[model samples]
Target: MTAGQVSNNGPKPLQRNLSRRVSFNEATLARSQEPPKPPAEPEFIDTEAQVVSRPPYSACCNSCCAWTSLVLAVLLLLSILVGGVYFAFLQSNLPQVRLHRLDVYYLEVNNTDTDTFLTSDLEVRLNFTNDNSKIKLSYSRMTASLTAEGVDLGTVTVPAITQEPSSSADVRARTWMRKTSAEEAVAEDLRDNSLKHLMVIDVVLKGHIDFLVNGNKMNGFPIKVSCRSIDQSEIDNGHAPKCGVQMTPL
Candidate 1:
């Protein structure tokens, strides 16, 4: 009941409430040190965007196809044109050959009952004509043979010659046989009169020719002339028989 006793009156109700509030504030400050939370999600947009591009086809492909078609058409047209030209002009005007004359210098036979021999010298003349008006003709490496009724008497070789367009030329070859088996057989036929005095002879000519067409020269085509069953009497009368000619390709 004195001053000391009043002073000792332990904590009123207000102090007690103030002490509880101070303790709660210290606890809230301790929890504030944790990591911060992430931000909230934003709203979504609803619009879409589109871009325009060029077409896939181009002019180069079309141009290449056009050129290819044009080239093929031109080649086909040229082939048809060349074929027509050859058939109309070049195929019909082939060269011709003739057998002009054959001259025998001497023919002698030596016969003993056991052995027979013969000797002769001869000359042959030929006429060649080129009927082509646009092409020039030439013959090379010429060779010839003389035969009588399947028996080959002799062979001759001649030099090369050139003939102008639409012109004729003459050539000659000389053959001589001395003491040969072929000559002996020919002599036996003459003695036996097996030819019936017709004196039939054959002339064969073989060679290659060159033809110049449109300023271009092409060679190595074969030329063959064959004259058969020619009479000696015709030669003496200054006349000749026609011969056949062929162009054989090699």
Candidate 2:
């Protein structure tokens, strides 16, 4: 080939390569300037689908706890209401008791060098009244104690008694003080009072009582009856003193 023809062929191949490089650079530049394609629209991810679901047992447990709390609250309210009603019923329907009579059989006092000997016999009568129209009262065996001037004279057993609704009952107890000793001063006072027929004595009765309401027997409770300052003159004058009755607290 001639020298001019070879140079021309070489320059045409170089021009073709240059043109291809320019086309590739323009395509890259165009892609870089095209508003970045809005970051490919974030791949259309759903946030709710990605979140972890709660366990079924957890919801069930919460519901159960709520129901339990509600039930307990209801039970507490019912208990309070029932307690209030029971207390009211108790306050309105209490039994009535009193002393009916007192009797002195004999009293004797003897003096010695060191102490004084005393012997006495006495009887006590108590009246129990049940004012409740629908309830009955049953008393257990009781003990009666006799005291003269803060000195225990004797103790005796009293028989149990039952009273129907709106009815009254009486209990009698007899006590004998045998060969009891006392101080000289106390014996002198007792002897002087006995001679003058003006002796005073106190009686205390302790027992348990049960109530029957609507054919149901209730639990028993302790009871105390006190008859204080029973004078012989008052008994002679046909006056029956009223006694004080106390029961265990509910």
Candidate 3:
């Protein structure tokens, strides 16, 4: 009925509403300042709790599942790409060395009518060249020897005369093994014993190749001249026996 009483009663509803609004605003502000949420709580429905699931999924839940699947797929793809990149990077650092091809030839001599060809006891020619344009050859002496029907004639080093990159030139190397007239007679007798008891000849050669052996270029592939002795009668018939040598190119 009085002025103060009327004023107090008139503002009571507005004051209560204002206070409620202020409390709500304060709660919203506190939520903003709070640390990030600890992710959503997983919903697990007990099978025993009689609950019916519809055929069509809830739209919100379907959208969340789809988003989760997309994120996992992206992560998987990123991991695979990173692994592939790492493998390629590792492969580039590995060493890749190649070898060159080498060829060897054999020449047989039994009887010679010309005296000019009697300079050496036995001569063997060989070739070492790079068939690939990208590869180069690095080697040491070529050691070759002779064998007659599983017999050791001898072994010697093949000297290198010249090397021209244009056409792989022949080294024209020679090997000598001393043989006396008595030795010749014995060899002839042995040959006469059996025609099929043919002689076996082998030439073994090796040298320092481009590859490092124990951290040295002087150690590489071993040379081998394993060939059969050509027919001596062919040489007596006025024809040279075929040279039996192999090629090795680095």
Candidate 4:
């Protein structure tokens, strides 16, 4: 080989090396030109948790409601029992009162031009019966009003009385009225009835009564006895008519 000329084999090796270096540089430049990749994000996992909670006063409220219901039920039961006992006692232990006889002694009516005057004398008898086995009854003063043919004659007062169980009592009342003003028509009717001996009188008695259970005084109740159309002839003929009795709450 000449000194000035390069050998072909040596040059060929150099060329090969330069080509490899050039290919590696091209690959690095291509990687640089591409866009940069973002950082990897952390993986996320979804999880569900179950929790149990209760109100602060739930147990206390439940207990209070239970006690309240129990108390109300007990009170209701007691009231029912007491009411039933009271009703039963009242039904079985009430006293009975009746009007036995009514006697009219003198009845006179005088009439003027436009006015009328009446004079009368009457007697009333009442019979009171207590059928209770263990109760006693006491009565207040009784007032009796007499009416003849729709004319108010007079009113009489009877004394108070007391009756034991299974016992009876009789009361008598007398009334004398003189020169009482009356309606003309009513006075005429009374005069005619009195002359024919067919006069009828209505007697209404009002009073109050109290019951004693084992010597304990109970509440007082009002009593009313009504004797309607009491015939004077029937009383004179030894016949007694029964009257209606009513007992009411005070």
Candidate 5:
């Protein structure tokens, strides 16, 4: 063929080859830039042979937890039982005190001047009863005071005594009152015509009562005894008066 015709045919084959190579490179670049088709989602299969993961804690840890729970349950049960017993036995039964006999006497009376000191003596016979069938009561010490019209008198002390369950103990104390100004005032008030027929006195007792249960002693609890509005006529007639007692704090 001629030189021009050969050049034309050669260029046509070369151009075709170049066009095919460019198309292939463009397709490859487009596929790469399209995020690689999202990496093809994995297929899910349902089978019995599939594995299940367990918790990180081993069997030993599970056993420890169970034992801890059991111990706590046992402790709670014991606490409830002990509380029930205490309520039924110890808490329900309380001690009582009663005034069995009381007497008052006036001594060294002077209607004239010289301060007119008044002295009095009181005989207090108290019955201490323990109503509990299982617990024993111990009254370690006791001290009592007499008062009239807000004036404090001397104190009376009683020795220690222990009372068995369902038993009673007798407590005897002799209290005296001797004051100068207050005694004169009290005597004057008592001797008044209107009040002479209706005279009253106040008595206060302070002490500690301890409880013994199953060889254990629970003590340090305070007790207060208040005897107020004690009619002198009733005491003179040999009739015991009523009073109230309470458990108090230190």
Candidate 6:
């Protein structure tokens, strides 16, 4: 074919459309074949900074130290005050208090009611001599324990006893020791009524106490309270003293 005949058979519209499609395809191909670009570098901050370290505060520590100092000062003051008081007490109350002699004069016990042990009464008489040269015992405290038939009954507190300087003083006290059933105490051991048969009494005269220098406690001479008898000659000779009263059935 001739050149003019081939050009006449070619499609003009289709060729224009094919050329646009090839242009888009070539742009896409070139974009897919290109290498990726690196990311932009991060921005650098160029700011001047000031370093600051907070200083320690001692408000709570100072408060605690002040409180501890106050407590220690208060404790030291209290100790000094107590020591001064103890020293003053020692200086004022302590004195040479001597015990002379405590002698029992009389003892009485009556047990008329065997069933009721509380209706009984007792009277004890005592004498004390003051042998101290510096101090005089004006008042005394005496305690006595009573027992019946080898059984402890009760205790009795005597009143104050007074003795002059190098002189003897008499003391007497009478009271009931309340319900003291000596028979009930020993009922488990002995079946028979040992308490009803006869009256048995044991009296103990503890050491006499004297209030020296007003209220200070001091020792006094020892004495005994008993219902046992003694000879009249011995009593007159100041040896064995006789007791006037004895025990009665309860």
TM-score of each: 0.60, 0.63, 0.34, 0.64, 0.56, 0.32
lDDT of 1 by residue, 34-108 (tens): 667787788665434222243445699789889999999999999999977864554455577777777777556
Which predicted model would earn the best TM-score? 4
- Candidate 3's residue-wise lDDT over 1-250, tens digit each? 8999998799889999999999999999999999997989889878655445445578998999999999999999999999789555333321222111121222222443422111124454444443333323444666666555554556666653323222253444445544322244445544452243333334455443343223433234333334345444433344433333232332
The candidate scoring highest on lDDT is 4
- Per-residue lDDT tens digits for candidate 6, residues 61-111, read 889989999999999999999988955543332222212222222222334
- Model 6 / residue 27 / CA error / Å: 86
In model 5, the Cα lDDT at residue 199 comes to 55
Cα lDDT of model 2 by residue, 1-250, tens digit: 9999998788888899999999999999999888855455557767676564634567889999999999999999999999889766664555666665667677778877777888888787777778988988888868889887666778988888888999988888888987788776786787577667687878888888787899998756777788888886776677777777766532
Error of 3 at 116 (Å): 27
Cα lDDT over the full model 5: 0.71
- Candidate 2 or 1, higher TM-score: 2
Off by over 4 Å in 4: 1-81, 84-88
Better of 2 and 5 by lDDT: 2
Q: Model 6 reaches what TM-score against the true structure?
A: 0.32
Model 5 misplacement above 4 A: 1-92, 111-114, 183-185, 191-198, 235-239
RMSD of 1: 18.5
| Lowest lDDT 10-residue stretch of candidate 4 | 46-55
Off by over 4 Å in 3: 1-120, 160-167, 179-186, 189-200, 211-219, 229-250
Model 4 per-residue lDDT at 46:
42
Clash number by candidate, in order: 0, 0, 24, 0, 0, 6
> Which residue runs of candidate 6 sit more than 4 Å off their true CA positions?
1-118, 138-141, 177-180, 184-201, 205-250
Clashes by residue pair, model 4 = none
| Reference-based TM-score, model 1 | 0.60
TM-score of 4: 0.64
Candidate 1 local accuracy as lDDT? 0.76
Alpha-carbon shift of residue 122 in model 4 (angstroms): 1.0
lDDT of 4 at 10: 63
